[model samples]
Target: MSEPHVHASHPDIARRPRRAEGQLRKVIEMTEAGRNCLDIAQQLQAVESAVAGAKRTPVQDHLDHCLEHAVGAMSRDQRQSIDAFKAITKYL
Candidate 1:
């Protein structure tokens, strides 16, 4: 037997566009504060739970979009720089 593919095609998806604006502001603030993936993931938990109860808001969606852009803009050297920064900052 094959496993079922669960997708989020619920009615709330349509309402997401409406909540996107405010959520986007919060995402920007978090990102600007230099929160890393783990921090973002933790915050995502709260956002996801809220989304489950209501609709898919723009905070996570905006974070996803911004992260995609930031990562795409990095070159190999830039990524290495980030790794080095992480290594040094790890001790602090």
Candidate 2:
């Protein structure tokens, strides 16, 4: 496969960041309002988690679509990218 096939995950993955964006904005507002520390921390954590989840979807989609293409074409660079991507997920 020369080009990646569009996997079914794209639409949902696209939406995930939008939700996180709103949540992140709320975090800023909450900070400005001098919200309780615990509440702020909780919301910040939620935002971080949401953002992480949103990122995971696209990375996973890339792995599903692009990696398959790369493997089929025997591209070492893409394989190396897959390895690098997987290594970073330990932090995620």
Candidate 3:
């Protein structure tokens, strides 16, 4: 049997990490400039949230496209669905 085709629409998922990189640079600069700790913390939180969102996007896409499509077949086998779910849960 051939492998199922994966969806390719989550292109912006990769871009989110690049945004986090810039946010990190800003956090570093804020630290060096003796900015308020609260300001720095907020930016750090933004970066963390962005990174999490980046991680989640592909998983969401996988569930929406891949798992949704695979379920019809794996509903019989079950193992593949469970394994795929366990793998994706790390992002949670």
Candidate 4:
């Protein structure tokens, strides 16, 4: 039997730049419009699904850079607030 191909094992993955500025800009715009994290995640899913076979560099970039930085800078209360928001959004 032959094995199925998997893009995750591809060699070019590291070279991909996750979270291009354009994608980040879209995310910011959505947030500014009062869209919740779930909404943002849905949009990200659409983008990922639509661009199948391509590396999701932009999304990863946002997580690595913007989200990481924001979380790192937050106080305990702010972190709790974000965590609570995420819990509600994810379960809803």
| Best by the lDDT measure | 3
The estimated TM-scores of all candidates read 0.30, 0.64, 0.70, 0.28
lDDT of 4 by residue, 1-92 (tens): 89853344334443322433355567779989999999888766655543442344344444445566676877787777756654554322
> How many clashing pairs in candidate 4?
4
Which scores better on lDDT, 1 or 2?
Answer: 2
Candidate 3: tens digits of C-alpha lDDT, residues 1-92: 99864557456887899999999999999999999999999999999998999988777777767666665555546667666775767668
Model 4: worst 10 consecutive residues (lDDT sum): 12-21
The model with the greater TM-score, 2 or 4, is 2
Weakest lDDT window of 10 consecutive positions for candidate 2 = 69-78
Candidate 1 positional error at 35, Å: 1.3
* TM-score leader: 3
Tens digits of lDDT, candidate 1, 1-92: 99863334434555544355455556677889987877766666655554554533333343345445666767787778655654454333
lDDT of each structure? 0.54, 0.77, 0.81, 0.56
Model 4 stretches astray by more than 4 angstroms: 1-26, 53-92
lDDT at 80, model 3: 72
- Give the candidates in order of lDDT, highest first: 3, 2, 4, 1
Model 1: CA > 4 A from native: 1-24, 55-92
